[model samples]
Target: MKILPFVALTATLFSSGAAFATEQTVTLNVANATCELCGPIVKGSLSKVSGVLDVQISEADGAAIAKVRFEDSRTNVPALITATTNAGYPSRIVQ
Candidate 1:
């Protein structure tokens, strides 16, 4: 079976020096993300998210990845999806 891809919320946690943590991950298959032209759009969209520190879009792979580091208390995965959708590329929250 072919499971649908999750375009957002690929959060990863890393230890911070003091009391901070980072959830950085790769989201896949934003349906509208196609062609080389979609790269910038995807990246720009993901970058607008509050927790996201950076974004990387691969047109060849149809992937929109977000590097997010949130306050753990502030937001959660679903918010990430909303951010991408707000930018016009609605996405799923990958596990």
Candidate 2:
């Protein structure tokens, strides 16, 4: 009986890979965010994406830096890039 329970636990852990999903944070460069209105638009777009947990935009010079946290299983860096670009903000991963 003890051996059977241990085998079942091991199998369960391997079967649902997504259950171990982790959060990821990325910084993006928003090149066109030179004005006050730009930050809100960029933030709104990022906030609307599914699995996006948080978004923070900081402006400096003529650009905006966006830090975003999201669940890796539901979204990714490419999706984040697309969101801002579609909003007319035009962003790229910082690294």
State TM-scores per candidate: 0.54, 0.81
Clashes of each: 0, 0
lDDT of 1: 0.57
Quantify all predictions' global Cα lDDT against the true fold.
0.57, 0.93
- Tell me how far the alpha carbon of residue 87 in candidate 1 is from the true structure, in angstroms, after superposition: 2.1
Pairs with steric clashes in candidate 1: none
Q: What is the Cα-based lDDT of residue 3 in candidate 1?
A: 32
Residues 1-95, model 2: lDDT tens digits? 77999999888987867677799999999988999999999999999999899999999789999999999988999999999999988888889
Can you write out model 1's per-residue Cα lDDT over 1-95, one digit (the tens) per residue?
A: 23323322222222332236445564545667666666677676666666665555544355554444443344565776676677777777556
Error of 1 at 13 (Å): 20
What TM-score should be assigned to candidate 2? 0.81
Off by over 4 Å in 2: 1-17
